[model samples]
Target: AALAQGRQPLLLERTAGLGGRARSLFARDVDSMIDNGQHVLAASYHETRRLLRRLGQENAIHFQQPLSIHFRFNQRRNFPFRAWRLPAPLHFLLPLLFGAPLSRSDRRYLFRWGRRFRQTVPEQLKPLTVRQWLDEAGQSPLLEQLLWEPLTLATLNTPLRQASAFLLYQVLQKAFLSSAATSGLGLATRLLGEIFARPAEQFIRQQG
Candidate 1:
């Protein structure tokens, strides 16, 4: 839609036939079959969903409904949070009531943080890492290690110890809302090359 609506720039950066990231090349006698990883897309990707639907390929893509979150440092230990897409305004509160990974106290602070942000000017709010927020809120290191640390690292792709506490708090706050909105989403599993590259090239050649 962005391309159709002139909201995105159109340009081909490379000149050549595009290729898929073939994962395995199995030579079976006279024929060779390649297997690739199953690609997954986030249900919340409105643009990709819209484009696929427009191309009549929505069926090829799958939606994992009642989105659930899974966390693991290892396979033996994992925490799961399940959620349902709420109708509307009520959706915002469900994460608090259910499908939340945070401890009851941490969850309360997450809400309080948002309410505080709403009431204060952005410039005045103290900036710190998620760890800082946890500490300031009186969350123990043990809780921080199991909870905020993983969440911060998972969301920011940065070590919790290194991340800015203030920024992390805001990021955590944002993720919390988005998760609530979508019944708690984690990712779109599709590889960049498979989901976007070929189709994009095809679209470009057709339109160019």
Candidate 2:
């Protein structure tokens, strides 16, 4: 953003690379590139997308359409959850209601949970953990195990018992209820260095 505003911003990195935690390694033996960790982005990451666009590397990230998630419980059982091309909330809500691998009772519980989330104010959530919030909101055990637990762990990198309710609530609002496009999943098609770090370095040098 500073670069876009005609300000020469100096970026200082102690590491040899620019990507920090999100970087890749090139193996000379196999001539293959490997990421340090898998980094997935949601369309709700507006600032990230904007920065990529500023670096002219938007196409380096490949985005999935319609926000589909495939969950494999077993070799024989796979559940696919796909969002509709509808408006905000409905796009995600309809899928949870009808298409997700949830039982009728689970769906009802989820609906009630959604209602409670909608009514909740951010300030009221600071003192609670995600597990406590879910229990208070009457989240079904099945739904918590199958969906919320995994999602919470993936998003917060913390167990529901330890994760903050307010943090999870903000993520839910952005990914599920913001807009149809906000839930789209983005994967970097190129190496992390090529996609972001190298381009950013070049941009900075050019500016300097």
Candidate 3:
């Protein structure tokens, strides 16, 4: 953006790599590249998308359509949760109501909670633990195990008992309730180096 605006921007990397923790390494034995860690981007990551587009590497990221989740519980049991092509909140609602593995009672609880969540603001949430908030919200144990716990771990990198409820609420609000596209998952098809680092380096050198 700075380059486009005729302004010079200097990016300093403390480490040898540009991506920092979000980097890739070649596995010579398999002749393939692997990431240091699993990184999935939500469509709501506007800044990241903008940067990728600026670097002309937007197509390097493969995005899933309609936002679906497949859960493998065991070797024999797997559950598929698919979002419908409905508008805004209905996209979230129809999915959880009809597609998810929740029981009737669980669905009812979640529906009521969703209504409450829409009405409440993120700042209004207390600094309670995620587990405490879930309990207070009457989240079912199955729902917690199947959805909330995993999401909490992935997003906050902390256990639900330790993660802040306010932060989790903010994530949910931005990712799910914001828009249909916001919830779409994007996975980088190329190595992380090819996806961002190499292009960024080239862009910087051209600017110089």
Candidate 4:
């Protein structure tokens, strides 16, 4: 960003490696490269995707067309959630309303929160945690167990009782409500170091 703005940015790294915790290590025991964690990406990350394209590493990450997720509840039962290729909100809304494993009454709770999500400001949600917000919104226990709870953990890496409602709202808005394409999941096809860190460092040094 600094370079794009005609500014020379000085990078200060405390460790020898770039990408911080998003780096990869060669595991001789496993005989393969392994990332520190499963660093998943959302297609909503437009700027990051653009950067990958600029670096000619666009193929390093693979994205789904539209959005789809399969939740395995048990050994036999599996729930598939797929968003249509429609516009923003409708893509996910159709699946949530008709296909989700929720009772009709429980699905109705979406209307209230849907309105609130559109109307409420960040300041109004700042004091509440995700659990509190869901409770106040009359979200059923089943809905929380199946959808919101898992989503909160995956996106924020925090428990629903501790995660900020405002943050959760922001993530949902950007990743799901913005556009159908944005809701898709993206996974790196290569090692983190090769896909991002090394290429990024090389690009930066060459520019400097």
Candidate 5:
């Protein structure tokens, strides 16, 4: 809003209230919202800073000083079997080096997988699940358990069995093949911001 412009953009909120989902109670002593589960803000998550900054609460939001990721497995879900790197390879390689989850053969599978994925995509939307491709490429169950699950769910929000292998492959290429970090820049931070806001806060407040 401080940005100087020839024409001021019209801003509106659909809801009667101003705060949207993260609202506040009438009194300063009250709390507004509580998210059910834990979430993270990556160092690379740019505008998150801007929003938090705008609210004069940037310091309040805990930015992962040294960003990290976690891998959880079925039923036990005890703790993340391990952590991963937010940017990608640097995070992945540490574990591979220490053999936290991936073994020597698993590492080879990852290398081969990256090389192969580097080569296809929206240009070639093949009909194979990532699991299928990995298995065919000789990846084992252990490899799938350790390396693939976190990515399948977290990155794409779908299971390997049902999700598009091509889509996941594209994500890998964008994250690993191109840049040092998948999240360096140019990625959309909030789909809602990009897609809405004539009355965005209104919709959020009243959202089901």
Candidate 6:
């Protein structure tokens, strides 16, 4: 924001790396550089995408359109989660209806909750935890294990029992309930050091 306002911003780093917590490391055991953390980017990450665009590192990320993912339950079995080309909600809904290993009761409960979710505002869920919200929504243990738990862990980086429901709802609104294009999954083509930290540092230097 400071740079956009014609100000020369001075970036200071306490550590030697640029990306702070989202950085890379050289492990002697591996004999190569590796990311300290794994990051999965979503198409709904508008601000992040904009920043990468500004850094001229847009090509460093690759997006998978039509929203396809494979979740492995065991070495022998996996679930294929693919969204339809339909509009918002339906794209995700149809896939869940046909592809997911959900019981009829789970489906009914989810549909009811989906209606309530659309009607309620983010503030309404402010006091609730993700686990509480799911429980109140009549989410089955199987449903929670198959979908909600993993989704919450991946997106919020917080355990379901502790993560705020409001934030999870907002993520659902933006990443899944939004348009198909926004729901697509994106991944960095390179390591965090090469794709983000190094490129961002170079960008800042060039701006000066």
Candidate 3 segments exceeding 4 Å error: 1-14, 26-32, 125-129, 153-164
Clashing pairs in 4: none
TM-score, one value per model: 0.51, 0.82, 0.81, 0.84, 0.49, 0.89
How well does candidate 2 match the true structure, expressed as C-alpha RMSD? Answer: 2.9
In what order do the candidates fall by TM-score, top score first? 6, 4, 2, 3, 1, 5
List where candidate 1 sits over 4 angstroms from the true fold.
Answer: 1-43, 52-62, 73-77, 84-181, 186-190
- True-vs-predicted CA distance for residue 196, candidate 3, Å: 1.6
Flag clash pairs in model 3: none
Off by over 4 Å in 6: 8-15
Tens-digit per-residue lDDT, 154-196, candidate 4: 7776889999999999889998888897898888898878888
Whole-model Cα lDDT of every candidate shown, in order? 0.53, 0.80, 0.80, 0.83, 0.50, 0.83
Residues 72-162, candidate 6, lDDT per residue (tens digit)? 8888867899888888788888788778888898888777776776788788899999999887777889888888888887777788999
CA error at residue 201 for candidate 1, angstroms: 1.3
The clash count for each model shown is 11, 0, 0, 0, 2, 0
Q: How close is candidate 5 to the true structure, as a TM-score?
A: 0.49
- Alpha-carbon RMSD to native, per candidate: 6.9, 2.9, 3.0, 2.5, 8.4, 2.0
3 or 5, greater by TM-score:
3
- Please provide, for model 2 over 140-160, each residue's C-alpha lDDT reduced to its tens digit, 9 standing for 90 to 100: 776787678877876676789
Ranking by lDDT: 4, 6, 2, 3, 1, 5
Please list all clashing residue pairs in model 6, or write none if there are none: none
Model 4: ten consecutive residues of lowest lDDT: 109-118
Q: How many clashes in candidate 1?
A: 11
Better of 1 and 6 by TM-score: 6
